[model samples]
Target: MDDLRRIDLNLLLTLHALLAEQHVTRAARRLHKSQPAISHALAQLREIFKDPLLTRRGAAMALTPRAQDLQRPLEAALNQLTSLLREGAFDPHQAIRHFRVAMSDYAAHLVLPTLVKRLRDQAPGIDIAVCQASREAMLAQLGDGEIDMALGVFPDTPSNIWVETLFQEHFISVADKRSLPLRGKLSLAQWLARPHVLVATRPDADNEIDSALAAQGLHRHIALVLPHWSASTKVLTDTDLILTVASRTLDPVLHGQELMQFTPPFKLPRFPFQQAWHIRRDSDPAHHWFRSTVMDCSRTSPQSGEKQAVSR
Candidate 1:
């Protein structure tokens, strides 16, 4: 096509490396190309874009204003190109790659550790990083390569982003051992009357679960707003306030807490937890491997109505 001829796609990629390393030798090493070939690509790029994208400094290269502006767009394009050329079929056991992911404290607690060990044995060169990032930031992180994927919920997520439901995590009432609720399932009337603690990744998240309860014309009383479910375990153990948390959160010990699944005060929806990534990374082999590992963790975790017992 005409578009293909005008844009020497390979030049965009060479420029990306040149701009990043600020040295042809280093960039050549990264791209696994000969230094002279990268130089030729840079020359072609300068003529095509009609700008001296980079200039020589004392011992390194510096970007012109035009080059500075091209950083994000160029990196995004090359990453896309490289991802497309990558073998779509991912092989977990033989692959060597880095997979950086963003997840809530809850998900990190419930997942990842198991996979890290498996990756150690199955794919020794594979590197993994799991850190916390808000849903608002997930999209930008995915696009920029700061994170290849994120695990959590994104109810009001934007359309530009892509999400796959990893699993349906159900809620269970959790409390401290001293104040654990009755062992048997409590009736809806009994549940609504008790004071409760609500946990969320963000302030608006509190409203999400509350709004769902409002739709049924039945709502539970919330006595506290906590930052994470881990903190709630401490509250529920020391106090009688029922904390509605995912049953998966029960795995990690919290100073001896007791968890019980009680009949909801009304019909409660399952937490539609999922892993979301940008469309740009849809074809990346490394990204695919990381996502598949997380999905495997989710599928293997306890499913509906099953109980997990834990202690400090």
Candidate 2:
């Protein structure tokens, strides 16, 4: 521990560059140091580790077996340290990061396109991977770092997670403009009478519309059940099926189709669409940028209140 304390932190930086570049001159250029300085650091690192980290192979420098073993773990340690040290300032333009997000299809349709466009314009090197998972699975993934963030309606979140409401989305009924007589608002009786298409991705998932109907001892004639939002478009376009969907999901699902949207007759609770991440990532600069960008993109109204930041 005393020897560890005596070690210079800058040597770790130099070692990182040396291991990455493998060549003295290149490592010197990368570290903005003279060749002799990099050589000295490399010699010291060799003495400390008792291994010649880099070896000369004809004309090029090759990593020794010990250096090859150290590559991944050392890089990971340095990266974690860098992230810890640079918690508040993130330069998006030059940053290279892959962000994994867990979201439902509805949230993806509502948020990803706009988010992608903004990312392209601002942070070209950043990449995104979207995963479809249940609320429980998403929360687990967030905890395990399998996913960086989650965007959906997650109620009763655990204390270890942080959540920020992006918007409040209410259910709306959509139908082919030519097939349905949509005037202003849809009545519950009219909604029940029409052949309805239900978007149930999972069998056991509780739907707000179904819950609302069940409370009033009412049920709609479910003509079809689809696992995806895009599947409803073709069926709604050709048939007389009226599909109930989140208001934000309407525009993307009915991109070129002629669809009429109206408020549902009964008062269904407006669910909060939120972005959640583990509490561990609350102070991460890149994570903060991602949360802010998603919030900005998905906010329906300026009047939609922002929740206070909670850290555990």
Candidate 3:
């Protein structure tokens, strides 16, 4: 405590700039200080640390072992202090951050394009890294801080997770026009007669569609079980297999002449499409801004509403 009290905070900032740049002139330019000022701070830092923190190595300066040890902790401490000072103020236009998100291909297709476009226009410095994972893995990643957010149908989340409904999504069936001549709607008998393509992250387990069918004491033969919703619709082009998927995932199929869509013959209720994050991030300004931007992008879908939010 005595050693800490003896050190000046301003000198530590100067040391950070110097260590990051490794050159007096460069560090001065970075901190907007004169080269002499940085040199003076470097001298004081060396005295305080009782060592030459930076030593000349050929044409460039390199950090001494002691300086190298302090680099990461010093940077983290400064960042935490900065975050504390700006807790409630987040300027998207000036913020440079990278966010990791987890979602299925269906939800990515529904929201990413609009989300990216909006980011380009409003928050150019922000970048997004998306990963695809099963529901269980997504929730686990959220809890571990491996992912910043997740978008999908998440139910019965833990007390530390928060969910905001982006929209209500319903399923629709699609089949190759060449294979199934009928359009508009199919009777339950016709639907059961045709082979179906099931898109599920876990192929072994039953999905909502299968559960819905089983409730009525009926079942459809799943000829193909695949995880890619975006590519599953194309599989129907040359086969008799039918794919029942989220409505937005079939947007291209709706316009293409190769395939046709019809209402699901069973009573599969509309599920809430949602975005979830760890409660630890609930009050973070950057995270709050990003969640709001995602919610705005979700409005691009034709049928979006039922604004429900639950946090614990």
The numbered model that scores best in TM-score is 3
Off by over 4 Å in 2: 1-88, 182-186, 252-257, 303-312
lDDT of 1 by residue, 60-147 (tens): 6778888877866765666666666764556767777877788877887767777777788777888887777667677567644477
Residue range 36-55, candidate 3, lDDT tens digits: 98899999999999989999
lDDT of each: 0.68, 0.78, 0.82
Pairs with backbone N, CA or C atoms under 3 Å apart (clashes), candidate 1? 176-236, 176-237
- Residue 54 accuracy (lDDT) in model 3: 94
- The list of candidate 1 runs beyond 4 A from truth reads 1-85, 88-96, 143-145, 176-189, 217-219, 252-259, 301-312
Please report, as a residue range, the 10-residue window in candidate 3 with the lowest summed lDDT: 303-312
Error of 1 at 184 (Å): 3.6
The CA root-mean-square deviation of candidate 3, after full C-alpha superposition on the true structure, stands at 12.0
- What TM-score, computed on C-alpha atoms, does each candidate reach? 0.63, 0.65, 0.68
lDDT of predicted model 1: 0.68
